[model samples]
Target: MRIRKKIWNNDAEPIIAIMVVLMVLGTINVFSSSFVLGTTDYENPYHFLRRHVLVMLAGLVLFFAFRKINYRRWRPLQGPLMLAVIGATFLSLVGVLVIGTEVNGAKRWLFGAQPAELAKLVSLMLAASTLSARIKRGKANSLFNVCNMKYGLIVVMAVLIELEPDMGTAAIVLGVPVIMAVVAGMSFKYVLGLGGFLALLILILVNVQPYRMARLKVWFDPWADAQGMGYQTVQSLSTIGSGGFWGMGLGEGVSKYEYLPEAHTDFAFAIFSQEHGYMGAFLVFLLLALLVLFCVRIANRAPDEFGQMLATGIMVLIAGQAIANIMMVGGLLPVVGVPLPFISYGGSSLMVSMVAMGMLLNICDHGRNAGGEFPKGEAKVTKSKDNKVHLKLVK
Candidate 1:
């Protein structure tokens, strides 16, 4: 008997649903958190909100555009993409130092784009491609072989970003690739050595910068300098505390009234917590957890080692950035300029995140249709005597 099979199972629907919900929540939170700053800085309460909505719309466009492309196509193009990303990152980072706009004492923007954000995504792609190639060649286990052009370029990118004085982003750029390498089967001893080197490097970086040291000190005791260096942390904790079990109600947050800084960007979660309470905070956590789980599933089902590594890198990027931002806000870590993935009000961050999700969804669709193994008694394909292709279910 003839049978039929669905060409596309839409395994990515859950991820898309979660993404849309996060975007909607983000839109509301951005407006709520930024109106006060918008009014003060631009003399219009809707200034930031309007800009944010435009960016979100553009992000959605890119998301759909990327989703339609084949994930495997990126593998062949990795070389050119790697060079382009490295060049753009180098120029953008240096150009920012020369002609980029300065916000709060750091120059991290050039031509309305944050190259560091784009670098993160591209670097992961390059890492995945390079590592997968190494694994295929039987050289993945060699530390010397693994430390190739791709790894070096990524390190350079991280250094340039750190020079932007954005240590938080630099850390993500540096850390995620190592995680990918480990997943690619790097030896444990090398992993430990690399970890020690990274930890020592972080220590030097933190100790070399007075501001970083201050942030570290503030992390330890915000109340010691509550009115000065530690003001934001103290206010963040207070804002979250005030939310109690249920938030203060949307738009009723008091911290955005100049008590807490960067309310819509790096510390957006605090404002969100202040307005929505513990339940709201938990909801965001749940969504992120779900997103991470979905990413793992996609990685496991990816069509090839390349796709698997790519998916793994994307998962690490989202989870790592979200954890860093939330921890910074909660005083579990020193303040870092990392933004919450979909929830932060930054165009570059949102755009990059959306594009990454798009690629992930593409991987999910590809895996479902082409990669996964078929179960027994499911539909099978055969050719008839007339040379017509037919699908039949095993009895």
Candidate 2:
């Protein structure tokens, strides 16, 4: 009874449904990928599946609880949230510098308790809040007058993220606000100019870092040095290709048996493609597309600019990670080390992704609430007393 209430109590059914589908797919696929990885440790190969269940439970709890609270409550948390995340990202970067943990020759952590991920969500919200306030004050349409107040704050946050050397995430974080600014009615000329400048900055960043250049070179053709920086991409392609149409069959993949590096983390998509085959890979992509479409729909129906921006930021967050992960796996882009959102085996990424989904659901809930109220013991709804009806007759 209690479980039913928790699961069915939301007005955000469409958003919740998308998350549920992803969680289910992720859980099944991870089992398919990790059973063999865990077989040596436990008699049952479903060890990771058990852990996945626990993680999903924790995530669902957060989902329901977060749904009850208004997201506006996060407004006051913006400054402190940014500070805390920046501190954590810096600590992780410096921690890697001091006692760095190396995986596949990269300093990114396997246990990314790093605040960078959390910062992505906070930074998005902060940017949304900052920009939304301007729009509400009717300054959004004003040329040379918008984005002046909190622009400093946004830049400082971006610089701190870039300082961590997490260019992929920093790029997405910065890009989102720019999108929000444009959507909020910032002038097109300004957006075009800002985008050009951002591109130049990225070029400089790539020029300055030898490894970044190497990754890009390998992205163009990993075969150039298959045994060097090109190694992972080559392995990823081989693994993905080996899967063919139906895949070699789950737990039967040759790659996760140690052929592919980062098999359980950042490059887990390669493992997935190997086990599930093209059909499986296509299904995963389809679900992701559906998830993206649903999030955008929710954003379109959002009651206010804050809600719209929040929904949009979260959608971009998921879509960005998906595109980056897929491109890396497919050998179309450098391995920027962004994990596959729901499908990757992770702690911080999993929970935070769930939180972002929760926020998305919260946005939908408000839309549904405004639309109608559920009648007791019935799924259909009627107008609530608290809300004034605004109707337009058919013209």
Name the candidate that leads on TM-score. 1
| Distance from true location, Cα of 306 in model 1, Å | 0.6
Per-candidate clash tally: 2, 0
Per-residue lDDT over 134-246 for candidate 2, one digit per residue giving the tens place of the 0 to 100 score: 65566664444334545555565556556656778777766776776777787777777777888899899998878898888777888999999998899999999998999
lDDT of 1 by residue, 81-101 (tens): 546656776788778878888
TM-score of each: 0.89, 0.80
* Segments in model 1 whose C-alpha atoms lie over 4 Å from true places: 1-9, 76-86, 369-395
* Collision count of model 1: 2
Tell me, by lDDT, which candidate is best: 1
C-alpha-based local distance difference test score of model 2: 0.72
In model 1, which residue pairs have backbone atoms overlapping below 3 Å? 247-276, 247-277
What is each predicted model's overall lDDT from 0 to 1? Answer: 0.85, 0.72
lDDT of 2 at 341: 87
